[model samples]
Target: MWNQPYLETCCRSALHRLTLVGRPGRPDGLKDGPCLRRLEGMGLARQREDGRFEATPAGWDRHALEIVPRKSA
Candidate 1:
């Protein structure tokens, strides 16, 4: 569902890092805003007890599919 360029970039960043700590406004933090809420609703993202945002396995799978294929030189 996160096929848009911006959304994919954000999700990829989150998936690659695995955890986003502290407040939602931080550059590296993922907020519980509309976008994230939708991801959470889809069982893709979750908010941790310590307020960290984490991507689920399904999220990783989806994000992985979006990775660009590298060409062999």
Candidate 2:
């Protein structure tokens, strides 16, 4: 589920935002709280002791499929 690139991308983006606060140590921002929790629950992401969430190995294995563009007839 989370292995999908699309999901991983979303998780990465969320993590970036959470860490951008520059507070240093533990993420307490509510903006990413819910999304992070959900990602953790889904096993796509995990929170480290440092309070930062990292993508799991499984999350990297999934790939998101994209629709190919058809050539003009």
Candidate 3:
């Protein structure tokens, strides 16, 4: 249980989108700019040299723990 930064529902959705494996790590046009920027500010994601954003390692870890649902035992 890490004291991860609180994410808005929309930003959380954006982070999940960024973490999608393969399938082209593209963003949803300008709609995601602010959300991605916020994630960058939190060190959760980073912008690429080509002007696209990708999830950071920290982002991936956060996504797994916070975004992904756990299987009920």
Best model number under TM-score: 3
**Candidate 2 residue pairs in backbone clash:** 3-62
Residue-by-residue lDDT tens digits, candidate 3, 19-45: 884335655367978898999999998
**Which of candidates 1 and 2 is the stronger one according to lDDT?**
1
Candidate 1 vs. truth: CA RMSD? 6.3
Candidate 2 lDDT tens digits, 1-73: 5344344555555545434433352364566677676667777557778776654544333212222234668
Candidate 2 residue 17 Cα shift, in angstroms, is: 7.3
- After TM-score superposition, the amount by which residue 58's alpha carbon in candidate 2 deviates from its true location, in angstroms, is 1.6
lDDT of each: 0.54, 0.52, 0.83
RMSD of each: 6.3, 7.7, 2.3
User: Candidate 3: misplaced stretches above 4 Å?
Assistant: 21-23, 27-29
Candidate 1: worst 10 consecutive residues by lDDT? 19-28
Question: Which 10 residues in a row give candidate 3 its minimum summed lDDT?
Answer: 21-30
lDDT of 1 at 33: 49
**Best-first order by TM-score:** 3, 1, 2
- Taking all chains together, the TM-score of candidate 3 against the true structure is 0.82
Q: Quick one: RMSD of model 2? A: 7.7
Provide the lowest-lDDT 10-residue window in model 2: 60-69
